[model samples]
Target: MTGKTVGVLGFPFSKGQPKGGTELAPKELRAAGIVDRIQALGNNVIDHGDVDLSGLPADSKVGVAKNSLAVGEANKKLSEDVAKYLKKGEQVLLLGGDHSLGIGSLHGHTQVQPDTVVVWVDAHADLNTPFTSDSKNMHGMPLAYVVKEMAQFLPKTPGLEWCKPSLSTKDIVYIGLRDVDPGERKFIEQLGISCFSMHEVDKFAIKDVVEKALSQVDPSGNRPIHVSFDVDAMDPIHAASTGTKVPGGLTLREAFYIAEEIAATGRLSVLDMVEVNPKLGSPEEKEVTVANTVSVTAKFYGSKRQGDVPPNYVIPRPQA
Candidate 1:
């Protein structure tokens, strides 16, 4: 991943769920030195700023989906921005307001790199349709909107008419899932998507889980990778500020291992770092969540646990 120009885009809109502080993730992450950390890894970093989420329609629920109009419009704008940055040959790093932002990121990525494979790292399967969702939050339904196989199961959502399902089920792989819903489990089994739940992680180990996930999604190992990582995928101890954190999630080391492995692939084109809510926890918890999130993100951009030397560095020598 050296020499790559990383484009950082923030989605400061959180209409996908009933949360407020999530909209502040981009600002918080920036304040925590995310930009400097990535730049230190010897890659050129460009902060593209946050996506505009203003003046969107406040339409009522479209079927069982809540915040339909606002979520759809914001995602449309996000998709365009993502595609623009990708066209400029920069690897896109999306800092999200919530998991719902995955809808737009995936849509825009497929517009430029249709053959990209997805590695969705989250505690929840997030494959529920509007009808299947009890909360009606769009955050839990992003996968349903983007997956081609799930299209038939979706209702005609008003604001989401622009979202055409483009990704095949076979092109996606899941990691770190532990709190999957019944509907999501049905879809996973019926559609044959490769999933590495906490059960699998415990049995096969993180290294093997990652290797098998990549192999199943992109057997040729040449396709571009898009990792949609929800910080809630980590245990509540590591990420207590998220909205829907389930216990017994990935450890900090396991999370870093996954990110490091993805970075080594050299095919990571877009990454979504999401679900950090600064308002949900105490100052100490928020600090821990933000720090952990930043660390995991840096790993995906070439920071290594062993250590990293800046590009073109030379050891100090005695002066003549």
Candidate 2:
């Protein structure tokens, strides 16, 4: 138990990409006992319920970006909600409909904590711009919309006008990257963002990768941390229910190690756990995915693999 109050918000939205059933993640995760599990860890848990994603504008394709209006509208609401909870002094945990929710989560977090540093744990960079992306999925372009350095490259996206670029390219570090777009690769090189792809993860190990990522992003070690974790960061075996499946990803231990290390920082202010689509896999696969996700999430809030002790306890004297 970190003695922190965690505010949980669910985004039952899937318009960021061309997928259904992602909208059901919040309900599914709750059914799996996400709130209760965190409560057992000794923190005050408040389930804020799912964000209302109704009555969005009937948006058409804006250039290459699909569902621009709906994505933007939903995220605007998400941004406001996230900022509200953070202002109340509770650490926020955002459960997603897709990675697109990152736009609002990051936007809202930076609004309250301007000096926040981001550790993006995903197999894909999610850094593509509309012009650069072939699929035109908003989920793949969340970072592009919010990163200040990429602002010049972005066109005037219609529904996203309310979102201002709040994060600098240097304020973010990437881990578990295995599949990256060519344009995204160019962006990373040109912008000089620190990236530790699976290659580095294999070479340096998860522990070193996490340490180096944190050090590179926040050398002073005092900045508030936002971990935007996509379940697809793990190998398909661990998280097979996501829309995007990139093989040869992080192992379960590696995933837990990252969460544990981040939890140890004590500066984790917001965590976005995204891309668990319940509609994508077999029944058994979905169960495994949800269970693994819940387990990993618990680690971020002080649940130890070695088992946790209650905050205070005493040794019982024999027959006292």
lDDT top scorer: 1
- Model 1 root mean square deviation, Cα atoms: 1.0
- lDDT by residue (1-320, candidate 2, tens digit) is 54789999999999998879788888899999998888888889999998888898987545558999999999999999999999999999999989999999999999999999999999999999998999999999999999999999998888999999999999999999999999999999999999999999999999999999999999999999999999999999999999999999999999999999999999999999899999999999999999999999999998899987766656678894
**What's the C-alpha lDDT at position 70 in model 1?**
87
Tell me the TM-score of each prediction against the true structure: 0.98, 0.97
TM-score of 1: 0.98
Residue 86's lDDT within candidate 2 is 98
**Top TM-score prediction, candidate number:** 1
lDDT of each: 0.94, 0.93
Model 1 pairs in collision = none
